[model samples]
Target: MLLEALTHTWPWYIAGPLIGLFVPLLQLVGDKQLGISGNLRHLCSALLPRRIDFLRYDWRGAGAWNLIFALGTLLGGWIGVHLLGTGEIAISPDTQASLHALGVHDLSGLVPHEIISWEGLLTVRGFVSVVAGGFLVGFGTAYAGGCTSGHAISGLSNFQLRSLFAVLGFFAGGLLATHLLLPLLF
Candidate 1:
C-alpha cells in the first residue's frame, strides 16, 4: 500500500544514490546549486524589494524553483508525520549503550525527551544543548556560507574547495561536541 511504502525507511544504498543523483539531475535540468541557505537570501530579496542592494534583484527568476522545492520538503514532512505516522528511529545497540553511558536513559522518541523537553530546556545542560547549540549551528552555517547538506552534498559533488574545508570543520566540531563538551554537560 501507499501508506506502507511511506512508513518504511528506504535502505541507505537506495537513498544515498538517489540523493547523490540529485546534483547531476539538477545540473542537467537547470545548472542550479542545491542548497537551502541561499533560499533565505531569495526570500529576503522578494520581501524587502529595494532597500538593500543585495536584495534588489528579481528573486523569482533565480529562486522560484527552490521555493517550490522548500514547500515540497515541508509538505513531505507533514505527510510523513501526519499521514504515514512512522515515528520510531532505529538506533543501533552500540549507539544506545553509548547514549546510556552518557546518562541518556530514554530513547522512546527520535530524540531523548528527558534531555530535550521544556523542563530539560530550563536545566543548564539542556539550555546549552538546545539554545546555545542552535545559535552556534546558525552562526556556523552563515560563517561557512552554507549548511552541511549544501556543502557536503552539493558543493563536494561540484569539487568546491570552500565546501571541503567547511565539511572538515563540521566533522571536527562534531567530534569536539561528542568527546569533550557533551561529557562535561551531561
Candidate 2:
C-alpha cells in the first residue's frame, strides 16, 4: 500500500493540505523561508568572490537550511524516479485532444519532447517556448521577490499582503500563457 501510494500521484485534496501544512512545520522547526529561487543566490554567494554587492552576504547563516532542503528535494526526486518509479501522468482526454491539435502527440513523459528536446531547441518555436519562457520565469521570480511556491505557500500562510498580489499575478500570467501564448507558440 505504501509503495503504491509512493509510486502514484496523490489527489489534490490529499497533496494540497500536506503542502499547506509544510509551511508552518518549516517555520516551527527553524523559521526558514520555503523557497527554491533563493537557493541560486545562496549558491552563487558561496562560490563567487565577495566583490559583487548582491553575492556578498552571510549565505551560510541565512540559507544553509534552504540549501540542505534543496539537496534533499533533489535526492527525493532521484529516489522517487529511480527506486519507486512513477505512474503515467493522467491527462484528460479533452486536454490531450487540444494538445494533439496543437501538434503535441507524444504524452509519454513529464513534458512534451516535441517542445523540449535538443532538436526542438534549435527551432524557433522551441527557442521561444523554452529559452524565452525560462528567462521570463526567472525575471518574474526575482521581481516578485519569490517563486509561486514561496509566495502561494509560505508568504500567504504568514498573511503577507505582497504575497497575495504576487500569487494573483502568477495566476494571471499562467492564464495568459496557457490561453494566448501557448497556442501561438505551438
- Among the numbered candidates, top TM-score falls to 2
Positional deviation of residue 13's Cα in model 2 after best superposition, in angstroms: 1.9
- The regions of model 1 sitting more than 4 angstroms off are 1-6, 40-64
Q: What is the lDDT of residue 143 in candidate 1?
A: 70
Candidate 1 weakest lDDT stretch, 10 residues: 2-11
- TM-score of each model, in listed order: 0.81, 0.89
Compared with the true structure, what per-residue lDDT tens digits does model 1 show for residues 1-186? 976766777679878998888778878999887787767778778887667776788799988999998898899888877777755778799999998999999888656787788999988888898999978976688678788668999989879999999999999999999999999999
1-186: candidate 2 lDDT, tens digit per residue: 987887887789998999888777888998767888887778878998469887898999989999999999999889977887867899899999988888888898777787888888988878888899888987788678799678988889889999999999999999999889888878
State the displacement of the C-alpha of residue 73, model 2, in Å, after optimal TM-score superposition. 1.1
Error of 1 at 33 (Å): 1.2
